[model samples]
Target chain A: MTGRVPEGLRELLAQAAGEGHAPWRTLLKAGDWALLLMAALLVAASYPLLWRGGVADRAIVKRDGQLVTELALNTPRKYEVVGAIGTTVIEVQPGRARVLSDPGPRQYCVQQGWLTRANAVAICAPNHVTLQLSGRSGQNGAYDTLNY
Target chain B: MAPMTPSTIELPVTADDYRIARYAAAAIALTVAETALPSPLPGIKPGLANIIVLVVLARYGWRDAAWVSLLRVVAGSLVIGQFLAPGFFLALAGALCSLAVLALAQYLPPRFFGPVSASVLAAFAHIGGQIVLARLWLVPHDGVFYLLPLFATAALVFGAINGLVAARLLDLPAVAPAEAAA
Candidate 1:
């Protein structure tokens, strides 16, 4: 209590306590602004690293969460899955997959159209069928360590 | 019945316990209340309780702030009926990560870094930890990281706002004077 207060502590107290005339100036310190700027830059940088539209190598069809088949996207083909309700038709071409037709009432899966990017999914919930596109995960390489 | 001994029967509550309890209660209340507010997305939240944590860190110290923050997550999940559930673990992960960041951030030069800076850094850590956990346990897909920019933006926005609020609260004489003693 008797010793002199450090310059940093004094300034922080004065600014936060509103001893200054300007209200905005009291809101954030120089370090706070610097942190904010750095955070923005970091966020901006993540966009390229994370939002990747990887080309799918295969299409996986599932019924009731169980894998029905893995279709190579290189070969254009059509396959049918008999789900809970009725038959759902899936068509794969080159590097994309689409639901040609489904017994689901809403047709939301069909509306999803062609899913070309990795990890894209189309669900025919009424029929309990789902289609997902997967590619070689660049980060994970050829195998998932967790699988072993 | 015979009168109990004063030392054995009395609760071991101290000044620190009382302080932590007070702050923890406030943070827990805010955590529960935040759930009532409608969110556009599932994971995004204003994280109002973090304001209390930031203020406690700046005024009391990181230890008190850590206590308040961790307690809020545990108690808040219990109140919301999500204890031992996936959501609870997500919250715990986020809180733990943020506390770790605050521990380090507190050591930065005071002239440059303050409560606001610490709050922002903690916020980023919070979201980052959550995403990593979700990727490993819930989604199990690399695609999950795509949400980073969105979550990061939310962290920055809410973190700065909460930090500002904490700063304003610290302006009060009761809170401001503690910095010198601490």
Candidate 2:
């Protein structure tokens, strides 16, 4: 037996049942509206966190996992660091740094493009050298470091 | 014909048992199949098996749905040879969180709350649980949170699709027992 359902709701349900349509599509209940709003809000709130970008002021270079050099990013210059495998050329431009050349066969380090953000890093595994950017204003406003 | 006696009779299986078994098997199959596909990112999958769980939850209630989901995770992991592994634990965590969310979401008025909303909430909860567990046990680093945005986006997209699929399936008339037997 049908309970004391509203006429409008009963008719909508009947139509949905007859046509094999999802009833929620036709008439959204208050709960569904609330959930939809919440989902939208969540997506909007996370956009800034994911896409935050800032300029870096310091560039740190490491060789064989040891700190070898640290440079101020304010000056534009190209420098080279010799590692066990070969030499790695680093290019610094204002607030960004990148690998101009690397001895690795694949040149993956050169392919890393640039490191302008505070936590950005580039590595030449074959030459055993790494370049990372950091600065007081470079932080993404998130966690300090990532494990995985 | 000889008259049948109580001693010669066999107990008939309940309809609920049959339905549960069918849905659980489907879920398990989906889970195993999903593992074979290559994923672009770690700990991310379409989670298509969740559609079955949602349908069961809508039709049979949360307890039966939970049973189906638990069976799927256990049997599916065993079939894929990932039982007791880190991957298995992550999957289990996601499933438990999703089920818990579904259970709570069911309290909303039926008119406004349906498979889509439930699926979305469940998906987010699933990801949240996995990330928390990963931080505590797997990665143990703050960096894991960096992947949250990617995981959250995946959940939103997949959750909406799965919810729609579940909604379509739920709209169908119940299968006749005679047809099911065939």
Best by TM-score: 1
- Candidate 1 residue pairs that clash: none
* Residue B88 miss distance in model 2 (angstroms): 0.6
Tell me chain A's TM-score in each of the predictions.
0.59, 0.59
- lDDT digits (tens) for residues A16-128 of candidate 1: 55653436447677888887998889888877766656646789899999999999887679999999999999998776889999998889999889887777888899999
Of candidate 2 chain B, the 10-residue stretch with the lowest lDDT total is B173-182
The residue-by-residue lDDT of candidate 2 on B47-100, one tens digit each, is: 988988987888779998998899888988999999999988998999999999
| C-alpha lDDT of all candidate models, in order | 0.80, 0.78
Q: Write the per-residue lDDT of candidate 1 for residues B29-132, one digit (tens) a residue.
A: 77888999999877899998898898789878999999999999999899999999999999999999999999999898988776778888899999988999
What's the CA error at residue A128 for candidate 1, in Å? 32
Error of 2 at A30 (Å): 5.4
